[model samples]
Target: MKALKHLNKYFFQYKWYLILGTLFTFISNLFGVVPAQIVRYALDLVKETISLYFLYDGFGAQTVVYEIFAFSILLYGSLILIMALLKGIFLFFVRQTLIVMSRHIEYDLKNEIYHHYQTLPLSFYRKNNTGDLMARISEDVGKVRMYVGPSLMYGLNLISVFILVVGYMLSVNAKLTWYVLLPVPFLSGSIYFVNTIIIRKSEEIQANLSKISTFVQEAFSGIRVLKAFVQEEPSTVAFTKQSNIYREKSLDLVKVDSLFTPLVSILAGLSSVLVVYIGGQEVMAGRLTPGSITEFIMYVYMLTWPMIALGWTTSQIQRAAASQQRINEFLNIKTDIVSTKDISQPIEGAIDINHVRFVYPDSGIEALHDFSMHVKAGESVAILGTTGSGKSTVANLLCRMYDTTEGQIKVDGFELKEWNVQSLRGQIGYVPQDVFLFSDSIKNNVRFGSLDMSDEQVIQATKDADLYNNIMDFPEQFDTVLGERGVTLSGGQKQRLSIARAIAKSPKILILDDCLSAVDTKTEHQILNNLQEIMKGRTSVVISHRVSSAKLADKIIMLDGGHVIEQGTHEELMAKEGAYKELFEKQLQTEETNS
Candidate 1:
């Protein structure tokens, strides 16, 4: 009931269409039963007219009987033709209204789910799988549509037809009506029992399908790695195992349906046999006429569909309910990262991290401990650290990707929580270590950080990142569509493109986190020189392991574990003969050895 309530807005929004469709369904079913009553009347007329002709035994009596029979036949034929035409017309409109309404609602729900996904925090994405989410939006939403459209339409039609047919049957013979409806209770019980199994099986099937989707999505995303490591066969085996589980779950659902459908048909068949046997005996006993028995049988036949439809509609509702629950779970997630609704103030480049502590949710390990730093407006600071030393964690905290567990992070005297999240992120340019480029043209990828950036700005950023010549050498140049994740470009080229994207944003604060690792030393040095002039007035945090990258910063901080071990200017840190100096000497020796 709660799941159904979630869909009420959509239902009410299109109530007019639903009401019209239901009205047409009622009219169509009404016309459908009229033909059966007409047949009964025609039969009774023929029997009475023949009896009168036998009694009179004259030419006049015979002529009257012939005229009555001819009129009755014409009336029945006309009623059949008119009723069939009306039923067809109304049924078409019923489908058009109800089915189309379901499609519209489906479209709305899909968009709503997608919009909800966009609002969710990065933590929510880490906890959920892309494949599972995709299955909910696609397959689960489809199941819900089945309940809204065809299932609702057929269920309503069954109830309307059942009521009219049963009322007419009772009118003809009350005793026979009781006997004909004996199997209904059993059928209802069977539907209730089977629906439980169907619901359980449906959930399992949906879960397994999500597994298959997850496996396929991961496999395709890492196809390059699989081929490079010669692990394609192993990946195929894993996918096959997941596929088999999906197939087995689907077959379990099919087995339940197979058993339930036949049981429903058998019960309907029993009702028909009971009506025929009992009504035939009543006819012979002179208590009921042949026409009444014929009408009773026709009503029993009409009841067959509603009984069969009971089982089908129950299954559809159960499956839809299971799917709705999954979708509701996703929609109900509370995003941990949200900004003050009323605040839209822009941030300045000044950053202050005061006694901050942070831990990753999944790992339960502290990424930063009592970490504190202050960057004056327009200052360039470099973070130098080894792997697992919290270099990237600092950058993430600064961007509010994950909020600090303790203390405060302020930008230009305002706390991080006080600023609108989108507004805060907009002012910062962040280039991650693992660069991700969309499968789009080079120009579009570079312009992604700031969609409204001009072409001249994009070209200048590319030149600054040392990627302009590489782009122009291509046939289509900026218009050339990149393969998935810019696979066509070299590692260095991809890294430079990521840098160009960030530069085009014209951000007040820029954080480049090991973004130049793929490029050679000479190329890295050239790019850094170009960026030096650009970073003059902007607050910049350059995070890297290489000493060359840190040496260019006005101030450098060296971290070990989750704590900062040293902080000073490049010359001051080198002169101290500490961790910074040791790293610098090692890199210089490696360069000399390579030369």
Candidate 2:
């Protein structure tokens, strides 16, 4: 019911269209019923001919009666043709307009969902499945479209048919109409009861469907790993289990639907039999004309379709309601990253973290406690940390992907939340660990960083990232198309491309999170050396697992368990004989052993 209310708001603006559509449908049904009544009259006229044969004294008059019957048939056929033409004309505009309206709704919904997704904290996506998100934006929105298009109109049509049939039936004989309608209450009760069960089953089915979609997407993405590890048998077994669950749920849906139509048919059929028996007796008792009795039976048959259509529409609406609930759940999630009121100053990259404590939203475990750091404008700092030492968390905080739970972070002497998010991001350049390049020309990918950048500027940026020679190697040069995720490029080439993208932005602050991990030691050194010259006087925060990479920084901070254990130059850290010294020694020993 709540879902219906939500869907109704989208259709509210088009209420006039719906009213006119219903009016046309009502007129079409009115013409439709006339043919059935005409057939009843023809049947009575044939019955009269049996007795009138004595007065005519010959079968020649039968030709004239036959001609009269043929003309009646032609008139009913003409009425049917007109009704079809009118319904088609009305439906043409309705369907065309409604489809356009549906497309508009779909576009707005997808845009809002994507915008909301972009503003949400990184932790939200970390806990949610990518496939499920795709399903909501693609499949769930389609469910809303189904309701708007067919289910809504079919539901109204059922109502119109019911009113027309019932009114005509009651006008013929109120007592007989009551007897014919006796099965209606039972049918209605059965439908209401079964709908509850169907809705519950549908929710479970939808959940399992999401799981299946997630599994398939994961399997395809990790196909290379599965083949390398020879895990095909296990994957097949898992896939079979999910597929079977889907099959079982689908069968349950079919079973419930099967019961619905038969039940409605039985009730309608029972009413039909009662009307025939009771109305036939009224004719024998001289209380009703034979033609009137035939018309009553015609109306009963007409009632059958409305009853069936109503039940089917009810079931479809219930499924759509379930889909709507899931869709709204996604749409209603609060974006965890938003700016506070009364703040809109341009940032200058002077970042300060004061007694800032952080926790994961789902786990509530502190990722960083009493962590404090400061970066003066145009300062270059390198962060060295182990696998889970909150190195990425620092970068994410600076990017405003997540907010501090227990302290304050300031940028340019103003609170972090006080800055406009877009302006802040626009001023910051981020090169992530897994370099991603769209399947586009190198020039376009570079220009994504700065949309208005000229080709000459892009060539200069590529040269700064040490990628100019590589781009010129291809016949198409800057216009060369890379495969998805730059699959056509080598690891070093992809990383260099990302560096070029970041440099193209010419940001005030640049945070590179292990973006050069794939490059060899010599290439890494060259890229870092080039960045030093190009990134001079820009606030730079480098996150790296390798000590050699941190050697280029003015100051290196060693982090352990989300705490900064040491902060100094390479010589100062080695002289302290602390965690940093031990890590440096271990790396030297590993290198010697590998040699």
Which candidate wins on lDDT?
1
Task: Tell me which residue pairs clash in candidate 2.
Answer: none
**lDDT digits (tens) for residues 226-290 of candidate 1:** 89999999998998898888888888888888876688678777877887899889988887887
lDDT scores in order: 0.88, 0.81
What candidate 1 gets wrong by more than 4 Å, as runs, is: 52-64, 281-287
Q: What does candidate 2's lDDT look like per residue over 486-537, in tens digits?
A: 8879998998999899889888889988888888767887888889887687
Compute the lDDT of residue 410 as modeled in candidate 2.
88
Candidate 2 structure, TM-score to reference: 0.91
Q: Relative to the unseen true structure, what is the C-alpha lDDT of residue 376 in candidate 1, on a scale of 0 to 100?
A: 94
> Distance from true position, residue 583, model 1, in Å?
0.7
Best by TM-score: 1
